[model samples]
Target: MAEPSNSGGSIVSGVAGRYASALFELAQETGAIDAVAADLSTFEALLAESEDLRRLVGSPVFSAEEQMSAITAILAAAKIGGVAANFIKLVASKRRLFLLPAMIRGYRALVAQAKGIVSARVSVAEAPSEALLAEIRTAIAQAAGAEIDLEVKVDPALIGGLVVRVGSRMIDASLRTKLNSIRLAMKEVR
Candidate 1:
């Protein structure tokens, strides 16, 4: 896969982006882009499912050795090998594990761009059903006129409805925002 250009505000340009770009380049050269992405997704899921792993990844109190040992064991148990595993282990050893989430995001953005897919973030009040998800995907895909990689986040604070963000454009249709708008309009009338 070709390297996505690192333009201004690009996902492949910061500290995390640098790591992600390096990993992406390596993956491309080795023809392991998909495998690395899968492994990274598995690790991200594990991070989301466990507070201990989150703490391990985010806390700076842990020594590099401690972090490396714990992460290595976790990766081994999770069967995440190859470039993904090595890249993560390197991050732990360098005491930069806290940036793992951003790195993963950067990597995903790179992969999406390379595959000619648009990345969209959808935030909803609750977890949407599979049918709802499909509908949203369809709607966005139609609007974008391209394949979309949807990342759904359940944010109860939204109360209802959903907010969709594609690249620099964001559509805020959440109940919370709607109510806020109404409140502002009423105040203006008074």
Candidate 2:
């Protein structure tokens, strides 16, 4: 697997953090981080596509044995072998499948950080065009002075404009927020 860029940092802590850290460390030691990350991305896409699979992982109704068997079969059929395959099986066997999503997120975060890529979330009134997204990426990378991974979410209620958040800093450029500010100013004027 190709290694990501030069993002320097250690993993996080807490339940999800601990699990992510362990998995990341193992993948790193085995030089399989990229492979594991790809597998996890595939798994995440599967979870998003299949409601029954989502329920199976997130709901407490299923027995651990059932989840393990089902997930094992799914992994095998998906041809998702390697550190990722084993790590997921372990999580299911431990009845921690409910935490899988968070673990995946945590893993992605670590991978991003390792790649020296800052993550930015942008919420827009509609799906952005590729040109717009590329523009945003260039702007953010320039501002951050680092490689960036952008996640765009669509919220029609925003009316117009987009909100950009990077780490603890946020730019509330959404029309909804601007309208709210105008309303607040009007109240003050009254």
Candidate 3:
């Protein structure tokens, strides 16, 4: 049998990694990796957009049954089923819902590695237009010598410019950082 794909073994670990790896292998074996990924992306987007959902997942005050009920309704409403839905329900049953985000991230890493894609995160002062996002993705893919899975974040604190992180390398070109550097330089001139 072919070796099961791994999330680099080092990129993700602990409870989240184990769960993610198991799900990834199952999805791969069933030829449903893409479908599972799409479901997970939907779940992740929902989790990001709803404060109540965040609390339900992250808070320990909810009992296992409560979480299971809530998550089941959520999955049904979101039309997320198959292996992804089952895996999430299992997590809820085991009272591990708080680790769902990490598990999704780990799953993403595994998928990216399998597809020869590099995951990159870009933080900017404002949301980039689709054209800008495509340009940035192309540039990063060229620099990394692989297709890029770009995750964009908007942080008004950046003031201007953007910061890109691809693996261990980071390029911080934010106006905030530049001004801080200049301020430190002037302090040294005293």
Best by TM-score: 2
lDDT of 3 by residue, 1-190 (tens): 3433544345667899989888989999999999999999999999999999999999999999999999999999999999999999999999999999999999998888878988899999999999999999999999999988888999999999999999889999999999999999999999
* Global Cα RMSD, each model: 2.7, 3.8, 2.7
Candidate no. 2 TM-score: 0.88
How well is each residue in 60-110 modelled by candidate 2, as lDDT tens digits? 999999999999999998899989999999999899999999999888987
Each prediction's TM-score versus the true structure: 0.82, 0.88, 0.84
**lDDT, each prediction:** 0.93, 0.89, 0.93
Model 3 lDDT-worst window of ten: 1-10
Query: What local lDDT does model 1 show for residue 170?
Result: 98
Clashes of 2: 2
Model 1 misplacement above 4 A = 1-3, 6-9, 155-160, 174-190
Model 1 weakest lDDT span, ten residues long? 1-10
Put down candidate 1 lDDT per residue, 93-188, tens digits, no spaces. Answer: 888999999999999989987888998999999999999999999999999988999999999999999999998899999999999999999999
